[model samples]
Target: MKLLLVEDDSDYAATLSRALEAMGHDVVVARDGVAAIEFNDRDQFDAIILDRMLPQMDGTTLVERLRERGQTLPVLMLSALGQSIDKVDGLKAGADDYVVKPTSVGEIDARLHALVRARGWKGEGATTLRAGAILVNPGKHRAWYGDDALDLSNLEFKLLAELTRHAGSFVTRTMLLERVWGYDFEPATNIIEVQIRALRRKLTASGSPDPIVTKRGVGYMLEA
Candidate 1:
């Protein structure tokens, strides 16, 4: 997945970028809100990670601007202020998810993954899905491949549910970010790829064929 990370802290950005790359994701970094907004206007990204306090324009204002332009990209906001009031303010300003600063990259990745999956549920009302040998129970939040139960994390379960719900349909990276991760702003991060890899590992471990079909330059689809 291609992600945009908007952060003014060079050291933190560098460290996070390296971690995401190590997990097989493509990351684009923007130093401040101005560059972040410019990047959003010019290029498409799967997801975005934004810092609450930024130069040029604050994260809240940037999100408001994007909303006005009718852009529905997923955004995860980061801040040092972890107060509930602050989180509410961010959400009211159009953020999908909010996290305090000094958060682990792993947790950020998980939250982003969840946001994407949430965005992918399109109310198809499909209760069950079969891909290869894998069986998904949407209502029960469980999956199995043959006799082996597939152990999934909360984020992983949501991811599978989304893919299965939209089985055979191409799910855009942006869509995944919006619904699954609940992000209303775009960030520069490679969270989608990271989560997919983890999900794949779990699926494959259950003796199932890879059910996820990747469309280069587009997004992902679950094989019908």
Candidate 2:
């Protein structure tokens, strides 16, 4: 997932950034609330990690401003103030979740997953995805084509889920690298082509017309 991390503490921010990258998340660091707002305005992010105390603007006020602007991105507020009242105040300001400072990256990752699950890709309570004859259930880690269940590996399932989510829209190779392989830096191996080849082979095993469309130099798309 792509994330925007708002932190004034450079050292702590660097450490946390490294940890999140190691967990396969791409992070953009913002040193202050103003920088955070700028980053949020410029790009897309799966979530935002905010610090309570910030230069230029406070975290609560920043969240409130984002809400006022009609941005619904999930926010996880971090603060040294671990009191129950502090948490309540953060939530009231439009933060999706609040975590105390010095929290582990594992805890943060879990919380982010929970937030994504709550704000499902399809809808508020959507659990399944469909593109043409293909059907995918990410929560169950299962997929099917017509009446036949697709036997996909872990990575293949994730790759297919992303494709099905977009359905008719083309998905770029870069997007697949970040979303499926979770790599901020590209590897030397042609992993995307290899995985797509394998997935394609399986998908067409039932003598069905290939649903994945390759645009040669552009990207891949699942036919809707």
- Highest TM-score scorer: 2
Please give, for residues 115-161, the per-residue lDDT of candidate 2 as tens digits: 97797633311556667667677776878775467999999999999
lDDT of each: 0.78, 0.85
The candidate that achieves the highest lDDT relative to the unseen native structure? 2
Give lDDT for model 2: 0.85
How many residue-pair clashes does candidate 1 contain?
A: 26
Angstrom error at residue 114, model 2 = 0.7
**lDDT tens string, model 1, 86-113?**
9998899888999998989899898878
Model 1: ten consecutive residues of lowest lDDT: 121-130
